[model samples]
Target: MKTALLLSGGMDSIALAWWKRPELAFTVDYGQLAATAEISASAAICSALDIPHTVLRFDAKALGSGDMAGTAPDPNAPASDWWPYRNQLLVTLVAMKAVATGVQRLWLGTVASDGIHKDGTPEFFENINRLLSHQEGGIVVEAPAIGLRTADLIRQSDIPRSMLAWAHSCHKADVPCCHCRGCNKHFETLQELDADVATGD
Candidate 1:
């Protein structure tokens, strides 16, 4: 259907990229501390997979909270690395771009564990899809990995460990710090699946 994926250069997203193999991928730098690493990783994966890739740049740092923005995770934050409707914001941006390029479907990397965040729920995707579908282009928002955890998706997709190496999961550092929540999940998932993770820049 001429799909596009919102590739975040993280484990789940990378797995989804290999699983769906969309025609194109989009990486947005909404002022995250790890934007540079994320974009580079995403671009490299896209190039290797022979998928067209693009980076959408903007400064949403003022709207961000927690480690992603160089601040402590707020005790009352909506979620770790919370950025105030981050998925919603990214979806809107990608939808606009996708519609312009004749893309009919847009995919996100949300996984089962991400349900803790309101925006990661199935209802959110359904609602967002409805909103976008009502528009002129009818670009649909779908989260193909919402039913599986990171480890499950990785194992199920059978994505090569070498290609999965292109993902950068640390929220605070260009090179993975291996201590943050994101990095912890990435490493833990690889360990659980008994996959050798490629580290370092």
Candidate 2:
């Protein structure tokens, strides 16, 4: 069975990729987020797993791009979280890619704790999956972390500790802005994971 992953090189997505390696990865460049670490880290994860990777480019903001596109970034907050329906569009693109690659299963990193988008709702995923399935050629979207907390994802996965450091959580490019909510969330996830690991979990 063929599997595809929606990789953004962020901590959550990266963790999903590492957990499901050997499955090809799909990343998009929709003129939205410009963090180059996405390129490097995604490539590294793909290479490490020997899984083929593709970068698709689309003009995401061409449509009425409102707060979703230009949602001002807070220097002290998460710029990545402000994208306009980014997850929805990303999943749409993932469905397109799945059709092209003859892969029906698309795995994403939507943890129950990922409240930033749709509050990590099952209805959200079901809505998307429902539409895709009704399309001429159907694709299935699955979020393994549906009921999982960020800490649980890290604890259950076999991702290495070293690579964990490279998991980008910042919304900006170059260096990580530790103050952002995205970064803070990942930091919390790591902290919880480390605690679990220390306690022999």
Candidate 3:
């Protein structure tokens, strides 16, 4: 059975892909807060795993008309972390890819630590799968990271820390800010497990 994984090339997504058995990697290049850098990192991650990967370009700017497409960061949002309906749209795109690619199982890397959800509740694979099932295709979005913390994911996957050296975790900056929500959250996850990541220690 063929499986498709939504790899964002970040720690969580990379871990998800590395944790799973050999499968195809499906990464969405949605006009993210960051651009080619994220996609480049994601490609490298998948390549290292020797998995077939597909890059899908999603124009969120044209699709998101809601609060998530904020031209500016919300006071509530961490700097450069502005984009609405991103999760939903990404999952939706994954489902479509699954249908077209003949992939039966789908995976994502979402975790409980994703406090950036518009609802304050991270929509793990369960929620997205439920909604996706209501659609026509039989694709299911599975977020193995939902129950596991980032630390757990890192402990489980074989991807090296060096692979993460260039991930664009910062929203506007070219590299990790180490203070932004994404970067801080990543740091916290590694800290929880005492794993060395972006930090030297």
Count of clashing residue pairs in every prediction: 0, 1, 1
Error of 1 at 149 (Å): 0.7
Using lDDT as the measure, what is the rank order of every candidate, best first? 1, 2, 3
How do the candidates rank by TM-score, highest first? 1, 2, 3
Please state the error at residue 172 of candidate 1 in Å: 1.2
All models: lDDT?
0.89, 0.71, 0.67
Q: TM-score per candidate, in order?
A: 0.93, 0.84, 0.79
The digit string of per-residue lDDT tens for model 1 on 1-201 reads 999999999999989999889999999999999999999999988988899999999889888888899987779887677767889999988887878899999999999988888898999998999999898998988999999999889877788889888889998989888898899888888777664433321
The whole-model C-alpha lDDT of candidate 2 against the native structure comes to: 0.71
lDDT minimum window of 10 residues, candidate 3: 63-72
- Considering every candidate listed, which one attains the maximal lDDT? 1
lDDT of model 2 at position 114: 67
Give Cα distance to truth, residue 193, candidate 2, Å: 2.6
- List residue ranges in candidate 1 displaced over 4 A: 195-201
Relative to the unseen true structure, what is the C-alpha lDDT of residue 98 in candidate 3, on a scale of 0 to 100?
A: 72
Model 3 error, position 55 (Å): 1.0
